[model samples]
Target chain A: MGRGMKRWMLWLPLAVFALLFAVVAAGLFRPADRTVRSAMIGKPIPNFTLPGMVPGKPGLATATLTAGRPHLVNVFASWCVPCIAEAPQLMRLKAMGVPIEGIAIRDTREDLLGFLRRNGDPYERIGDDQRSAVQVALGSSGVPESFVVDGAGTIVLQHVGDIRAEDVDDIAAAVRNAK
Target chain B: MAALCIALAAPVLADPSTPPAALAYTQLRDPAQEATAKALMETLRCLVCQGQSIADSDASLAGDMRSLVRERIAKGENPASIRAWLIQRYGDYVTYDPPLSAVTWPLWLAPIVLLAVGALLARQSFRRRPR
Candidate 1:
Protein backbone atom coordinates (compact mmCIF):
# COMPACT_ATOMS: atom_id res chain seq x y z
CA MET A 1 0.00 0.00 0.00
CA GLY A 2 1.16 3.55 -0.65
CA ARG A 3 2.27 5.56 2.44
CA GLY A 4 -0.64 8.05 2.16
CA MET A 5 -3.24 5.28 1.55
CA LYS A 6 -1.92 3.27 4.54
CA ARG A 7 -2.12 6.40 6.76
CA TRP A 8 -5.70 7.05 5.54
CA MET A 9 -6.66 3.39 6.33
CA LEU A 10 -5.20 3.76 9.86
CA TRP A 11 -7.64 6.69 10.56
CA LEU A 12 -10.64 4.90 9.02
CA PRO A 13 -11.88 3.45 12.35
CA LEU A 14 -11.77 6.89 14.01
CA ALA A 15 -13.46 8.49 11.02
CA VAL A 16 -16.22 5.84 11.13
CA PHE A 17 -16.67 6.34 14.88
CA ALA A 18 -16.93 10.13 14.47
CA LEU A 19 -19.48 9.76 11.67
CA LEU A 20 -21.55 7.31 13.74
CA PHE A 21 -21.35 9.61 16.77
CA ALA A 22 -22.49 12.60 14.71
CA VAL A 23 -25.53 10.71 13.40
CA VAL A 24 -26.47 9.39 16.88
CA ALA A 25 -25.93 12.75 18.58
CA ALA A 26 -28.03 14.53 16.00
CA GLY A 27 -30.81 12.01 16.54
CA LEU A 28 -30.50 12.34 20.31
CA PHE A 29 -30.70 16.13 20.27
CA ARG A 30 -33.32 16.54 17.57
CA PRO A 31 -35.44 13.43 18.00
CA ALA A 32 -37.64 12.01 15.25
CA ASP A 33 -41.09 13.64 15.03
CA ARG A 34 -43.21 11.47 17.31
CA THR A 35 -46.39 13.40 16.55
CA VAL A 36 -48.64 11.64 14.04
CA ARG A 37 -49.90 14.18 11.53
CA SER A 38 -53.36 12.92 10.64
CA ALA A 39 -53.76 11.80 7.04
CA MET A 40 -57.40 12.95 7.30
CA ILE A 41 -56.34 16.56 6.83
CA GLY A 42 -57.87 18.07 3.66
CA LYS A 43 -60.43 15.26 3.63
CA PRO A 44 -64.06 16.03 4.47
CA ILE A 45 -65.15 15.11 7.97
CA PRO A 46 -66.63 11.63 8.15
CA ASN A 47 -70.37 11.31 8.63
CA PHE A 48 -71.57 10.56 12.17
CA THR A 49 -73.98 11.97 14.76
CA LEU A 50 -72.56 11.74 18.26
CA PRO A 51 -75.03 12.17 21.14
CA GLY A 52 -74.49 15.15 23.39
CA MET A 53 -72.09 14.48 26.27
CA VAL A 54 -73.82 16.90 28.63
CA PRO A 55 -77.47 17.80 28.89
CA GLY A 56 -78.62 21.11 27.32
CA LYS A 57 -75.53 21.26 25.04
CA PRO A 58 -76.12 20.05 21.45
CA GLY A 59 -74.66 16.86 19.99
CA LEU A 60 -71.98 17.07 17.26
CA ALA A 61 -72.38 15.84 13.69
CA THR A 62 -70.76 16.27 10.27
CA ALA A 63 -73.73 18.35 9.10
CA THR A 64 -73.16 20.89 11.88
CA LEU A 65 -69.42 21.14 11.06
CA THR A 66 -70.10 22.02 7.46
CA ALA A 67 -72.75 24.60 8.39
CA GLY A 68 -71.38 27.56 6.40
CA ARG A 69 -68.70 28.60 8.92
CA PRO A 70 -65.24 27.61 10.08
CA HIS A 71 -64.88 26.04 13.51
CA LEU A 72 -62.54 24.09 15.83
CA VAL A 73 -63.08 20.46 16.84
CA ASN A 74 -61.20 19.58 20.00
CA VAL A 75 -60.75 15.94 21.03
CA PHE A 76 -60.38 15.75 24.77
CA ALA A 77 -61.14 13.64 27.85
CA SER A 78 -62.01 14.46 31.43
CA TRP A 79 -59.26 12.08 32.60
CA CYS A 80 -56.46 13.51 30.49
CA VAL A 81 -54.24 15.98 32.41
CA PRO A 82 -53.22 17.96 29.34
CA CYS A 83 -56.86 18.63 28.57
CA ILE A 84 -57.09 20.47 31.87
CA ALA A 85 -53.93 22.41 31.01
CA GLU A 86 -55.37 23.61 27.72
CA ALA A 87 -58.72 24.61 29.15
CA PRO A 88 -57.72 28.23 29.53
CA GLN A 89 -56.58 28.52 25.91
CA LEU A 90 -59.81 26.89 24.73
CA MET A 91 -61.76 29.45 26.75
CA ARG A 92 -59.63 32.21 25.26
CA LEU A 93 -60.36 30.94 21.77
CA LYS A 94 -64.05 30.83 22.60
CA ALA A 95 -63.83 34.38 23.86
CA MET A 96 -62.28 35.44 20.57
CA GLY A 97 -65.58 34.34 18.89
CA VAL A 98 -64.12 31.07 17.63
CA PRO A 99 -66.77 28.38 17.31
CA ILE A 100 -65.29 25.47 19.26
CA GLU A 101 -66.91 22.04 19.36
CA GLY A 102 -65.73 19.18 21.54
CA ILE A 103 -65.49 15.40 21.40
CA ALA A 104 -65.31 13.86 24.86
CA ILE A 105 -63.39 10.57 24.54
CA ARG A 106 -64.15 7.69 26.89
CA ASP A 107 -65.54 10.00 29.55
CA THR A 108 -68.60 9.49 31.68
CA ARG A 109 -71.52 11.93 31.85
CA GLU A 110 -70.78 12.77 35.49
CA ASP A 111 -67.08 13.22 34.80
CA LEU A 112 -67.84 15.34 31.78
CA LEU A 113 -70.10 17.56 33.86
CA GLY A 114 -67.44 17.87 36.55
CA PHE A 115 -64.69 18.65 33.99
CA LEU A 116 -66.82 21.38 32.42
CA ARG A 117 -67.70 22.85 35.82
CA ARG A 118 -64.06 22.93 36.96
CA ASN A 119 -62.80 24.34 33.65
CA GLY A 120 -65.33 26.73 32.20
CA ASP A 121 -67.20 25.21 29.25
CA PRO A 122 -65.94 26.71 25.98
CA TYR A 123 -67.75 24.22 23.76
CA GLU A 124 -70.94 25.06 21.89
CA ARG A 125 -71.61 21.41 21.05
CA ILE A 126 -70.02 18.52 22.95
CA GLY A 127 -70.13 14.99 21.54
CA ASP A 128 -69.66 11.85 23.57
CA ASP A 129 -67.10 9.60 21.85
CA GLN A 130 -67.70 6.84 24.40
CA ARG A 131 -65.84 4.23 22.30
CA SER A 132 -63.51 6.63 20.43
CA ALA A 133 -64.93 5.58 17.06
CA VAL A 134 -65.22 9.18 15.93
CA GLN A 135 -61.72 9.92 17.23
CA VAL A 136 -60.25 7.00 15.26
CA ALA A 137 -62.20 8.05 12.18
CA LEU A 138 -60.72 11.55 12.54
CA GLY A 139 -57.27 9.86 12.81
CA SER A 140 -56.74 11.34 16.28
CA SER A 141 -54.40 9.18 18.36
CA GLY A 142 -54.67 10.90 21.71
CA VAL A 143 -56.67 13.28 23.84
CA PRO A 144 -56.38 17.11 23.62
CA GLU A 145 -55.85 17.19 19.84
CA SER A 146 -57.59 19.91 17.86
CA PHE A 147 -58.47 20.35 14.21
CA VAL A 148 -59.55 23.39 12.27
CA VAL A 149 -62.46 22.61 9.97
CA ASP A 150 -63.58 24.88 7.15
CA GLY A 151 -67.14 25.68 6.05
CA ALA A 152 -66.86 22.96 3.42
CA GLY A 153 -66.27 20.39 6.24
CA THR A 154 -62.69 19.78 5.13
CA ILE A 155 -60.10 19.44 7.87
CA VAL A 156 -57.73 22.38 7.41
CA LEU A 157 -55.13 21.93 10.16
CA GLN A 158 -54.40 19.49 12.98
CA HIS A 159 -52.77 20.63 16.20
CA VAL A 160 -51.50 17.68 18.23
CA GLY A 161 -50.95 17.91 21.98
CA ASP A 162 -52.14 20.59 24.38
CA ILE A 163 -52.85 24.09 23.16
CA ARG A 164 -50.63 26.51 25.05
CA ALA A 165 -51.06 30.28 25.34
CA GLU A 166 -48.84 30.86 22.31
CA ASP A 167 -50.90 28.50 20.11
CA VAL A 168 -54.01 30.63 20.58
CA ASP A 169 -53.03 33.09 17.84
CA ASP A 170 -52.02 30.39 15.35
CA ILE A 171 -55.29 28.52 15.87
CA ALA A 172 -57.26 31.72 15.41
CA ALA A 173 -55.30 32.46 12.24
CA ALA A 174 -56.07 28.97 10.88
CA VAL A 175 -59.76 29.44 11.55
CA ARG A 176 -59.64 32.85 9.83
CA ASN A 177 -57.85 31.38 6.79
CA ALA A 178 -60.52 28.70 6.58
CA LYS A 179 -63.17 31.43 6.40
CA MET B 1 -38.84 -23.20 39.65
CA ALA B 2 -41.93 -25.38 40.02
CA ALA B 3 -43.90 -22.51 41.56
CA LEU B 4 -42.73 -20.07 38.88
CA CYS B 5 -43.75 -22.51 36.12
CA ILE B 6 -47.21 -22.85 37.67
CA ALA B 7 -47.57 -19.07 37.89
CA LEU B 8 -46.68 -18.73 34.21
CA ALA B 9 -49.10 -21.51 33.21
CA ALA B 10 -51.95 -20.36 35.44
CA PRO B 11 -53.84 -18.48 32.71
CA VAL B 12 -53.83 -21.47 30.38
CA LEU B 13 -55.07 -23.73 33.17
CA ALA B 14 -57.92 -21.38 34.13
CA ASP B 15 -61.53 -22.35 33.33
CA PRO B 16 -62.36 -21.95 29.63
CA SER B 17 -65.99 -21.06 30.50
CA THR B 18 -64.96 -17.72 31.99
CA PRO B 19 -66.50 -15.09 29.70
CA PRO B 20 -64.10 -12.68 27.99
CA ALA B 21 -63.77 -9.39 29.88
CA ALA B 22 -63.51 -6.95 26.97
CA LEU B 23 -65.53 -6.95 23.76
CA ALA B 24 -62.53 -5.96 21.69
CA TYR B 25 -60.20 -8.52 23.30
CA THR B 26 -62.50 -11.44 22.55
CA GLN B 27 -61.25 -13.81 19.84
CA LEU B 28 -63.49 -15.09 17.07
CA ARG B 29 -65.12 -18.51 17.61
CA ASP B 30 -63.91 -19.79 14.25
CA PRO B 31 -60.25 -20.81 14.61
CA ALA B 32 -59.41 -20.21 10.95
CA GLN B 33 -60.83 -16.69 10.92
CA GLU B 34 -59.21 -15.85 14.27
CA ALA B 35 -55.86 -17.09 12.94
CA THR B 36 -56.08 -14.78 9.93
CA ALA B 37 -57.03 -11.79 12.05
CA LYS B 38 -54.24 -12.52 14.56
CA ALA B 39 -51.67 -12.69 11.77
CA LEU B 40 -52.79 -9.32 10.42
CA MET B 41 -52.79 -7.81 13.92
CA GLU B 42 -49.17 -8.88 14.42
CA THR B 43 -48.20 -6.77 11.40
CA LEU B 44 -50.02 -3.63 12.62
CA ARG B 45 -48.22 -1.01 14.67
CA CYS B 46 -49.95 0.34 17.80
CA LEU B 47 -50.27 4.10 17.46
CA VAL B 48 -50.11 4.66 21.20
CA CYS B 49 -47.21 2.34 22.10
CA GLN B 50 -45.26 3.12 18.90
CA GLY B 51 -42.82 0.23 19.47
CA GLN B 52 -45.38 -2.59 19.85
CA SER B 53 -47.58 -4.21 17.21
CA ILE B 54 -51.34 -4.14 17.90
CA ALA B 55 -51.30 -7.91 18.64
CA ASP B 56 -48.57 -7.42 21.30
CA SER B 57 -49.96 -4.24 22.82
CA ASP B 58 -52.56 -3.93 25.58
CA ALA B 59 -53.39 -0.30 24.80
CA SER B 60 -57.09 0.42 24.37
CA LEU B 61 -56.49 1.74 20.85
CA ALA B 62 -54.79 -1.54 19.97
CA GLY B 63 -57.75 -3.44 21.38
CA ASP B 64 -60.10 -1.27 19.32
CA MET B 65 -57.97 -1.92 16.22
CA ARG B 66 -58.02 -5.64 16.98
CA SER B 67 -61.80 -5.55 17.26
CA LEU B 68 -62.09 -3.70 13.96
CA VAL B 69 -59.84 -6.27 12.26
CA ARG B 70 -61.73 -9.23 13.72
CA GLU B 71 -65.12 -7.78 12.82
CA ARG B 72 -63.96 -7.06 9.25
CA ILE B 73 -62.45 -10.54 8.86
CA ALA B 74 -65.70 -12.11 10.06
CA LYS B 75 -67.50 -10.11 7.37
CA GLY B 76 -65.33 -11.92 4.74
CA GLU B 77 -63.14 -8.90 4.05
CA ASN B 78 -59.56 -9.76 3.06
CA PRO B 79 -56.60 -8.61 5.17
CA ALA B 80 -55.24 -6.40 2.36
CA SER B 81 -58.45 -4.37 2.16
CA ILE B 82 -58.61 -4.01 5.92
CA ARG B 83 -54.99 -2.87 6.02
CA ALA B 84 -55.72 -0.39 3.27
CA TRP B 85 -58.66 1.04 5.25
CA LEU B 86 -56.48 1.59 8.34
CA ILE B 87 -53.63 3.05 6.25
CA GLN B 88 -56.06 5.46 4.69
CA ARG B 89 -57.18 6.83 8.04
CA TYR B 90 -53.98 6.60 10.12
CA GLY B 91 -51.39 6.86 7.34
CA ASP B 92 -48.66 4.28 6.55
CA TYR B 93 -47.32 4.45 10.12
CA VAL B 94 -49.94 1.93 11.28
CA THR B 95 -48.39 -0.91 9.27
CA TYR B 96 -45.17 -2.78 10.08
CA ASP B 97 -44.76 -3.65 6.40
CA PRO B 98 -44.27 -0.30 4.68
CA PRO B 99 -44.88 -0.20 0.94
CA LEU B 100 -42.26 1.25 -1.41
CA SER B 101 -42.73 5.01 -1.80
CA ALA B 102 -40.69 8.03 -2.88
CA VAL B 103 -39.45 8.56 0.70
CA THR B 104 -39.06 4.88 1.69
CA TRP B 105 -37.17 3.50 -1.36
CA PRO B 106 -33.89 4.39 0.34
CA LEU B 107 -34.73 2.25 3.40
CA TRP B 108 -35.23 -0.81 1.16
CA LEU B 109 -31.99 -0.19 -0.77
CA ALA B 110 -29.63 0.65 2.14
CA PRO B 111 -28.88 -2.94 3.22
CA ILE B 112 -27.95 -4.14 -0.30
CA VAL B 113 -25.84 -1.03 -0.93
CA LEU B 114 -23.99 -1.45 2.38
CA LEU B 115 -23.25 -5.13 1.67
CA ALA B 116 -21.93 -4.35 -1.83
CA VAL B 117 -19.61 -1.63 -0.46
CA GLY B 118 -18.36 -3.97 2.29
CA ALA B 119 -17.60 -6.72 -0.27
CA LEU B 120 -15.71 -4.31 -2.55
CA LEU B 121 -13.63 -3.00 0.37
CA ALA B 122 -12.88 -6.57 1.48
CA ARG B 123 -11.66 -7.46 -2.05
CA GLN B 124 -9.41 -4.36 -2.18
CA SER B 125 -7.93 -5.15 1.29
CA PHE B 126 -7.26 -8.80 0.29
CA ARG B 127 -5.45 -7.73 -2.93
CA ARG B 128 -3.27 -5.24 -0.98
CA ARG B 129 -2.18 -7.79 1.69
CA PRO B 130 1.49 -8.95 1.58
CA ARG B 131 1.75 -12.60 0.52
Candidate 2:
Protein backbone atom coordinates (compact mmCIF):
# COMPACT_ATOMS: atom_id res chain seq x y z
CA MET A 1 0.00 0.00 0.00
CA GLY A 2 1.09 3.58 -0.73
CA ARG A 3 2.15 5.84 2.21
CA GLY A 4 -0.82 8.15 1.55
CA MET A 5 -3.16 5.13 1.29
CA LYS A 6 -1.80 3.67 4.57
CA ARG A 7 -2.50 6.97 6.38
CA TRP A 8 -6.06 7.07 4.99
CA MET A 9 -6.68 3.46 6.09
CA LEU A 10 -5.52 4.32 9.62
CA TRP A 11 -8.16 7.12 9.72
CA LEU A 12 -10.89 4.64 8.67
CA PRO A 13 -10.59 2.58 11.92
CA LEU A 14 -10.72 5.72 14.10
CA ALA A 15 -13.69 7.03 12.12
CA VAL A 16 -15.50 3.70 12.54
CA PHE A 17 -14.65 3.60 16.24
CA ALA A 18 -15.94 7.15 16.67
CA LEU A 19 -19.17 6.27 14.86
CA LEU A 20 -19.68 3.18 17.06
CA PHE A 21 -18.92 5.16 20.19
CA ALA A 22 -21.43 7.83 19.22
CA VAL A 23 -24.10 5.19 18.62
CA VAL A 24 -23.52 3.62 22.02
CA ALA A 25 -23.34 6.97 23.78
CA ALA A 26 -26.54 8.12 22.16
CA GLY A 27 -28.30 5.01 23.33
CA LEU A 28 -26.91 5.44 26.82
CA PHE A 29 -27.92 9.10 27.15
CA ARG A 30 -31.36 8.72 25.62
CA PRO A 31 -34.13 8.07 28.10
CA ALA A 32 -35.50 4.58 27.60
CA ASP A 33 -39.19 3.70 27.83
CA ARG A 34 -39.57 2.54 31.41
CA THR A 35 -43.31 1.96 31.42
CA VAL A 36 -44.35 -1.45 32.65
CA ARG A 37 -46.63 -3.50 30.45
CA SER A 38 -50.18 -3.49 31.79
CA ALA A 39 -52.96 -5.50 30.14
CA MET A 40 -55.69 -3.83 32.20
CA ILE A 41 -55.37 -0.44 30.52
CA GLY A 42 -58.83 -0.56 28.99
CA LYS A 43 -60.23 -3.32 31.14
CA PRO A 44 -62.33 -3.20 34.27
CA ILE A 45 -60.80 -3.67 37.69
CA PRO A 46 -60.83 -7.29 38.91
CA ASN A 47 -63.09 -8.30 41.78
CA PHE A 48 -61.56 -8.33 45.25
CA THR A 49 -62.80 -7.76 48.81
CA LEU A 50 -60.12 -6.83 51.31
CA PRO A 51 -60.51 -6.27 55.02
CA GLY A 52 -60.47 -2.66 56.19
CA MET A 53 -57.31 -1.17 57.66
CA VAL A 54 -59.03 0.38 60.67
CA PRO A 55 -61.47 -1.28 63.05
CA GLY A 56 -65.25 -1.03 62.54
CA LYS A 57 -64.95 0.26 58.98
CA PRO A 58 -66.22 -1.46 55.88
CA GLY A 59 -63.74 -3.57 53.95
CA LEU A 60 -62.91 -2.38 50.44
CA ALA A 61 -64.78 -4.07 47.59
CA THR A 62 -64.28 -4.08 43.82
CA ALA A 63 -67.84 -2.80 43.54
CA THR A 64 -66.79 0.35 45.38
CA LEU A 65 -64.24 1.13 42.65
CA THR A 66 -66.89 1.40 39.95
CA ALA A 67 -68.91 3.93 41.94
CA GLY A 68 -69.79 6.16 38.94
CA ARG A 69 -66.73 8.44 39.20
CA PRO A 70 -63.08 8.35 38.33
CA HIS A 71 -60.81 7.21 41.13
CA LEU A 72 -57.24 6.10 41.85
CA VAL A 73 -56.29 2.66 43.15
CA ASN A 74 -52.89 2.87 44.81
CA VAL A 75 -51.06 -0.27 45.89
CA PHE A 76 -48.41 0.33 48.52
CA ALA A 77 -46.60 -1.08 51.51
CA SER A 78 -45.17 0.61 54.58
CA TRP A 79 -41.96 -1.25 53.88
CA CYS A 80 -41.59 0.14 50.37
CA VAL A 81 -39.38 3.21 50.34
CA PRO A 82 -41.01 4.68 47.27
CA CYS A 83 -44.39 4.51 48.98
CA ILE A 84 -43.12 6.85 51.63
CA ALA A 85 -41.65 9.16 48.99
CA GLU A 86 -44.92 9.22 47.10
CA ALA A 87 -46.98 9.87 50.22
CA PRO A 88 -46.84 13.62 49.70
CA GLN A 89 -48.06 13.30 46.13
CA LEU A 90 -50.94 11.13 47.30
CA MET A 91 -51.81 13.72 49.93
CA ARG A 92 -51.74 16.48 47.34
CA LEU A 93 -54.08 14.55 45.10
CA LYS A 94 -56.27 13.77 48.10
CA ALA A 95 -56.51 17.43 49.03
CA MET A 96 -57.59 18.19 45.48
CA GLY A 97 -60.62 15.91 46.04
CA VAL A 98 -59.39 12.85 44.25
CA PRO A 99 -60.79 9.65 45.72
CA ILE A 100 -57.73 7.48 46.38
CA GLU A 101 -58.07 3.90 47.59
CA GLY A 102 -55.13 2.14 49.18
CA ILE A 103 -54.05 -1.51 49.18
CA ALA A 104 -51.40 -2.23 51.77
CA ILE A 105 -49.28 -5.15 50.55
CA ARG A 106 -47.77 -7.47 53.14
CA ASP A 107 -47.86 -4.82 55.82
CA THR A 108 -49.22 -4.84 59.34
CA ARG A 109 -51.81 -2.34 60.54
CA GLU A 110 -49.38 -1.04 63.12
CA ASP A 111 -46.75 -0.30 60.48
CA LEU A 112 -49.41 1.22 58.24
CA LEU A 113 -50.67 3.45 61.05
CA GLY A 114 -47.11 4.53 61.75
CA PHE A 115 -46.58 5.23 58.05
CA LEU A 116 -49.70 7.34 57.96
CA ARG A 117 -48.68 9.16 61.10
CA ARG A 118 -45.29 9.96 59.63
CA ASN A 119 -46.42 10.89 56.11
CA GLY A 120 -50.09 11.93 56.47
CA ASP A 121 -53.10 9.76 55.57
CA PRO A 122 -54.63 10.53 52.18
CA TYR A 123 -56.36 7.29 51.32
CA GLU A 124 -60.13 7.22 51.52
CA ARG A 125 -60.09 3.51 52.32
CA ILE A 126 -57.29 1.01 53.02
CA GLY A 127 -57.18 -2.70 52.21
CA ASP A 128 -54.85 -5.00 54.09
CA ASP A 129 -53.28 -7.25 51.44
CA GLN A 130 -51.15 -9.30 53.80
CA ARG A 131 -51.12 -12.25 51.43
CA SER A 132 -50.87 -10.24 48.19
CA ALA A 133 -53.95 -12.04 46.82
CA VAL A 134 -55.53 -8.75 45.82
CA GLN A 135 -52.28 -7.59 44.29
CA VAL A 136 -52.22 -10.70 42.12
CA ALA A 137 -55.89 -10.24 41.20
CA LEU A 138 -55.15 -6.70 40.08
CA GLY A 139 -52.11 -7.97 38.05
CA SER A 140 -49.90 -5.63 40.01
CA SER A 141 -46.13 -6.21 40.19
CA GLY A 142 -44.81 -4.04 43.00
CA VAL A 143 -45.55 -1.41 45.58
CA PRO A 144 -46.50 2.27 45.14
CA GLU A 145 -48.28 1.65 41.84
CA SER A 146 -51.29 3.80 40.98
CA PHE A 147 -54.06 2.99 38.53
CA VAL A 148 -56.40 5.57 37.11
CA VAL A 149 -59.88 4.13 36.68
CA ASP A 150 -62.90 5.66 35.00
CA GLY A 151 -66.39 5.74 36.40
CA ALA A 152 -67.15 2.54 34.53
CA GLY A 153 -64.24 0.79 36.33
CA THR A 154 -61.94 0.61 33.33
CA ILE A 155 -58.28 1.28 34.00
CA VAL A 156 -56.99 4.13 31.87
CA LEU A 157 -53.33 4.31 32.87
CA GLN A 158 -50.88 2.96 35.40
CA HIS A 159 -48.15 4.90 37.15
CA VAL A 160 -45.68 2.16 37.99
CA GLY A 161 -43.36 3.92 40.41
CA ASP A 162 -43.42 6.54 43.11
CA ILE A 163 -45.44 9.58 42.13
CA ARG A 164 -42.98 12.42 42.13
CA ALA A 165 -44.12 16.09 42.16
CA GLU A 166 -43.80 16.24 38.38
CA ASP A 167 -45.88 13.09 37.98
CA VAL A 168 -48.92 14.87 39.37
CA ASP A 169 -49.50 16.30 35.91
CA ASP A 170 -49.46 12.86 34.33
CA ILE A 171 -51.82 11.58 37.01
CA ALA A 172 -54.10 14.57 36.51
CA ALA A 173 -54.08 14.02 32.77
CA ALA A 174 -54.82 10.34 33.25
CA VAL A 175 -57.77 11.14 35.51
CA ARG A 176 -59.14 13.68 33.05
CA ASN A 177 -58.84 11.14 30.26
CA ALA A 178 -60.47 8.45 32.38
CA LYS A 179 -63.57 10.59 32.70
CA MET B 1 -29.83 -23.39 31.48
CA ALA B 2 -29.14 -23.38 35.23
CA ALA B 3 -31.82 -20.73 35.62
CA LEU B 4 -34.48 -22.83 33.88
CA CYS B 5 -33.69 -25.92 35.94
CA ILE B 6 -33.75 -23.98 39.20
CA ALA B 7 -37.00 -22.31 38.15
CA LEU B 8 -38.61 -25.71 37.51
CA ALA B 9 -37.65 -26.95 40.96
CA ALA B 10 -39.00 -23.96 42.93
CA PRO B 11 -42.73 -24.85 42.84
CA VAL B 12 -42.15 -28.06 44.83
CA LEU B 13 -40.48 -26.10 47.60
CA ALA B 14 -43.08 -23.35 47.47
CA ASP B 15 -46.07 -25.49 48.47
CA PRO B 16 -47.92 -24.03 51.46
CA SER B 17 -49.71 -27.10 52.73
CA THR B 18 -48.59 -30.43 54.20
CA PRO B 19 -45.86 -31.04 56.73
CA PRO B 20 -42.76 -28.87 57.13
CA ALA B 21 -44.05 -25.39 57.95
CA ALA B 22 -40.74 -24.07 56.66
CA LEU B 23 -41.87 -24.71 53.09
CA ALA B 24 -42.84 -21.57 51.23
CA TYR B 25 -46.54 -20.88 51.83
CA THR B 26 -48.74 -21.69 48.81
CA GLN B 27 -51.92 -23.73 48.42
CA LEU B 28 -50.87 -26.09 45.65
CA ARG B 29 -50.49 -29.88 45.73
CA ASP B 30 -50.47 -32.82 43.32
CA PRO B 31 -47.46 -33.57 41.13
CA ALA B 32 -49.42 -32.98 37.92
CA GLN B 33 -50.49 -29.58 39.15
CA GLU B 34 -46.98 -28.80 40.37
CA ALA B 35 -45.48 -29.80 37.03
CA THR B 36 -47.95 -27.58 35.23
CA ALA B 37 -47.19 -24.77 37.65
CA LYS B 38 -43.44 -25.17 37.17
CA ALA B 39 -43.73 -25.17 33.39
CA LEU B 40 -45.91 -22.08 33.44
CA MET B 41 -43.69 -20.30 35.94
CA GLU B 42 -40.67 -20.90 33.72
CA THR B 43 -42.21 -18.69 31.04
CA LEU B 44 -43.53 -15.96 33.30
CA ARG B 45 -41.02 -13.29 34.26
CA CYS B 46 -40.79 -12.23 37.86
CA LEU B 47 -41.92 -8.64 37.59
CA VAL B 48 -40.23 -7.68 40.85
CA CYS B 49 -36.84 -9.15 39.93
CA GLN B 50 -37.25 -8.36 36.21
CA GLY B 51 -34.27 -10.58 35.37
CA GLN B 52 -35.45 -14.05 36.47
CA SER B 53 -38.42 -16.27 35.80
CA ILE B 54 -41.04 -16.47 38.55
CA ALA B 55 -39.88 -20.01 39.24
CA ASP B 56 -36.23 -18.96 39.55
CA SER B 57 -37.00 -15.95 41.70
CA ASP B 58 -37.38 -16.21 45.47
CA ALA B 59 -39.21 -12.89 45.76
CA SER B 60 -42.48 -12.94 47.69
CA LEU B 61 -44.26 -11.60 44.62
CA ALA B 62 -42.92 -14.48 42.56
CA GLY B 63 -44.25 -16.90 45.18
CA ASP B 64 -47.67 -15.30 44.94
CA MET B 65 -47.53 -15.66 41.17
CA ARG B 66 -46.62 -19.34 41.50
CA SER B 67 -49.56 -19.85 43.83
CA LEU B 68 -51.81 -18.07 41.35
CA VAL B 69 -50.61 -20.38 38.60
CA ARG B 70 -51.22 -23.44 40.77
CA GLU B 71 -54.70 -22.20 41.60
CA ARG B 72 -55.47 -21.77 37.93
CA ILE B 73 -54.13 -25.22 37.18
CA ALA B 74 -56.31 -26.76 39.90
CA LYS B 75 -59.38 -24.96 38.55
CA GLY B 76 -58.87 -26.88 35.26
CA GLU B 77 -57.83 -23.71 33.49
CA ASN B 78 -55.70 -24.19 30.39
CA PRO B 79 -52.14 -22.92 30.86
CA ALA B 80 -52.28 -21.07 27.54
CA SER B 81 -55.40 -19.23 28.64
CA ILE B 82 -53.77 -18.32 31.93
CA ARG B 83 -50.67 -17.07 30.08
CA ALA B 84 -52.94 -15.02 27.86
CA TRP B 85 -54.64 -13.51 30.88
CA LEU B 86 -51.30 -12.53 32.44
CA ILE B 87 -50.01 -11.15 29.12
CA GLN B 88 -53.17 -9.10 28.83
CA ARG B 89 -52.60 -7.71 32.31
CA TYR B 90 -48.82 -7.34 32.34
CA GLY B 91 -48.02 -6.91 28.63
CA ASP B 92 -45.56 -9.01 26.60
CA TYR B 93 -42.81 -8.39 29.15
CA VAL B 94 -44.48 -10.85 31.51
CA THR B 95 -43.45 -13.65 29.18
CA TYR B 96 -39.82 -14.57 28.65
CA ASP B 97 -40.53 -15.40 25.01
CA PRO B 98 -42.17 -12.49 23.27
CA PRO B 99 -44.03 -12.93 20.03
CA LEU B 100 -42.43 -11.68 16.81
CA SER B 101 -44.28 -8.74 15.31
CA ALA B 102 -43.68 -5.50 13.43
CA VAL B 103 -41.50 -4.00 16.16
CA THR B 104 -39.81 -7.23 17.16
CA TRP B 105 -38.90 -8.34 13.62
CA PRO B 106 -35.72 -6.30 13.77
CA LEU B 107 -34.79 -7.95 17.03
CA TRP B 108 -34.99 -11.30 15.26
CA LEU B 109 -33.38 -10.20 12.01
CA ALA B 110 -30.69 -7.59 12.71
CA PRO B 111 -27.99 -9.90 14.05
CA ILE B 112 -28.04 -12.22 11.01
CA VAL B 113 -27.84 -9.29 8.62
CA LEU B 114 -24.98 -7.80 10.60
CA LEU B 115 -23.09 -11.08 10.49
CA ALA B 116 -23.42 -11.25 6.70
CA VAL B 117 -22.12 -7.73 6.33
CA GLY B 118 -19.17 -8.57 8.59
CA ALA B 119 -18.33 -11.66 6.52
CA LEU B 120 -18.43 -9.68 3.26
CA LEU B 121 -16.09 -7.01 4.70
CA ALA B 122 -13.69 -9.66 5.99
CA ARG B 123 -13.53 -11.37 2.57
CA GLN B 124 -12.76 -8.06 0.83
CA SER B 125 -9.99 -7.33 3.36
CA PHE B 126 -8.46 -10.81 2.92
CA ARG B 127 -8.46 -10.48 -0.86
CA ARG B 128 -6.63 -7.15 -0.60
CA ARG B 129 -3.88 -8.63 1.63
CA PRO B 130 -0.49 -9.77 0.16
CA ARG B 131 -0.56 -13.16 1.97
* TM-score per model (chain B): 0.72, 0.61
For A82-105, candidate 2 gives per-residue lDDT tens digits of: 787899999998887788888888
Give the winner by DockQ: 2
**lDDT (Cα, 0-100) at B104 in candidate 1:** 87
lDDT of 1: 0.88
- For residues A24-44, write the lDDT of model 1, one tens digit per residue: 999999999988778999999
What DockQ values do the models have? 0.22, 0.27
Candidate 1: which stretches are off by over 4 Å?
A: A1-11, B1-23, B115-131
Model 2 regions more than 4 Å off = A1-26, B1-28, B106-131
Provide the DockQ value for model 2.
0.27
